[model samples]
Target: MFKINNLSVKFIILIILFASLIFGCTNNKINQIEDLRKNNNELNKTDTSSSPTKLTPKNTIIDLENTDSEERLLNNIFSSVAPSVVHINITKEMDVPSNQNIPDSFGFNFGIPDEPEQYFERGEGSGFVYDKEGHIVTNYHVVENAEVLEVSFIDGLTVKAKYIGGDPDSDLAVIKVLSDPSILYPVQLGNSDNTFIGQRAITIGNPFGQTWSLTAGVVSAVGRTMRSGNSAFSIPEMIQTDAAINPGNSGGPLLNSNGEVLGVNTMILSQSRSSSGVGFAVPVNIVKMVVPNIIANGTYIYPWLGVTLSNISLDIIDAMNLDLKQRGALIINVFDDSPAANSGLRDSQKNIEVSGGTITIGGDIVVSINETEVQTSDDVISYLVKYTQPKDTIVLKVLRDNTIIPIEVILDPRPGK
Candidate 1:
């Protein structure tokens, strides 16, 4: 049994709570001191030049030596955005009324009460204000099934937060607190499309309910993918980083060097169950794509393709006798009345017997899209995601025996009705 004092637990919680925001900062507070110096005689001719009596005017220089290179970034980022972020303590009622129960005669001194008792389950995470009306953004799993949500700030203020919206697919959620908007420090949204790998990435949040914690790292990779929650839907275009993200760092902002928000830190892969070299961020591109609809409409819209696709391998290329592997997506199945079907993308007719029990044939194999090469299923999806939008035309270079066909396929949204 591990014994720890209350203050020790509190300190550990505090350190974990401010996961990424405490290190590598040099205190250089930025002050806009006007450079008040007269330009010899030319300054004396201005319309309202504060009575320029220039003899030999010297300038005052203030160099804050303790300021580190990143202090400016920290100040600008934390000052303008700290209020938007909040320390969240979620309490869940773990007791459930169920017939499954252990007998009191078991060799255990513990006994269950006749009535269902409340078990206070507590967890901590972070969130950011998403809207002027005090809407906050955080990870969905951070507050999963939590009965009570308490939000706090660095200034010793606290409020009860209300659940707004969540998409398990993206692992993101919105929360709101009834508070004064005038005192709220909202973060500015940046263009994630412009975010590049190797740029500085920063995170700020309440890790383990310790408020106003911040950390920084560089963008490790772009266009990465991950999956989250029970629905098991795929998340694409995620950002990978080497930042130190721990358990309670969920839903914190991953920032660029310019102090612009780039992503939201959501998960980590570690053997020790702490931050390893790999931390994953939900790119702000995906966040912006989903959050507004979630805020306004209480749901998210996803772009979909009607056909299932498979990656083309050298074996599949040889076995299928493909003309060229870099043609397009090999459609295994197509939905009825889909835009792909209407656009003449055919589906496999019946099950083709192979090593497997059933296989489909007859569907047209897609070769290429516009000028982009489609060597695999991922290639096809990436090509479509980059070049085509909903109800947009996609030129598919298809192979049909010895004859090649150029088909103009119009893309459609997912979840076809």
Candidate 2:
């Protein structure tokens, strides 16, 4: 109804065109947003099976493969050797003074004790099956004076055992059980002479009365000698290990990584009555030597050198005016009509006190026997026990009066054999 100018009409047409263009753009944007939301919903509803699924890389398999080999070896060794190990319990009868105070007729206080009372002392140790004939090998001290011997297996079965024979010099003893041969597992004896330091050493025994406990270590040394049992004799060719062996671990097998018996765990050097990382084992080679003789006879006959020898110490070197590096067994005394006496080996004329200690002087020093060097008294004993027999002739290298002389000696059976 209102009159309009040409310029005004043009302005109104411009505004309407601008509005239409803006509305069209806004509607296009809304449609695009709706399409985007629909696409998102379709993506959310899609099944995982419709496409290949992405998986995280698994590294556990590789980790397991890397660790399985060593673990398997240890497991297999333990499984194979544990069955041959046994627990030994011994009961000994001891006489102890009775605590009862014998009162006078008036019941007056008196400190006089009653007669000695008998009591039972019990000990525990370890052993291994030696053969299929039910022979169990253990330390002689374990069964020494044992009134009752009992052997227990890993399966909790126990039986009374009888002492077959024992050699106190080697601290080894054999006992027999009446078990069936099919149930026994004899240990495989290894060549202890071939053992080397740093090789894996494993021990299975009843440590602190815990049955069939396993410990692992490395062989610390070989060819060691230690005093065994109550005897003054020394067990030679001992294997030294850092394995944790305690009171009940004696006579158990010291096994190599291949599960072969290298030695018999005998004693530990410790002040705490526990394992202090220094444990000794009797070499299987020595065991092999003594066990055969024990089985053949009721006892093992030890080969003797018929001379009392002492290791050449610094005191001896100073007193005797010998070479500083001279290491050998010094002959203290030779038995009458013995091998050393008959072979012209001279004994020490006198004992002289030196700054270090008292040493025997003017003795024939045994440097070697049959080309084998004698570095210590133990070395001489070890060589004789391992190599020589009765009635065998051995050539001795004697160092006397600054001269090296070869003396031939014929060995004889040890006296009182």
Q: Pick the candidate with the highest TM-score.
A: 2
Quantify all predictions' global Cα lDDT against the true fold. Answer: 0.73, 0.89
Inter-residue clash pairs, candidate 2? none
Tens-place lDDT per residue, model 2, 1-417, is: 988999999999999999999999999999999999999999789586786655647432223345677677777888899989999999999977655565788978666544547779999999999999999999998898899999999877899999889888889999999998988999999999999999999999999999999999999999887889658678888999998999999989999989999999999999998999999999999999999777778578776668988888878887888999999999998989888888788999788876766667788999999999888888888888898888889999999889999999888877666
Model 2, residue 183: displacement in angstroms? 0.7
Lowest-scoring 10 consecutive residues by lDDT in candidate 1? 24-33
lDDT accuracy of residue 193 in candidate 1: 80
Residue 165's lDDT in candidate 2: 90
For 33-66, candidate 1 gives per-residue lDDT tens digits of 2223334445656676576654653354334467
Identify the runs in model 1 with alpha carbons over 4 angstroms from their true place: 1-64, 93-99, 102-120, 322-376, 379-417
Off by over 4 Å in 2: 1-68, 97-117, 415-417
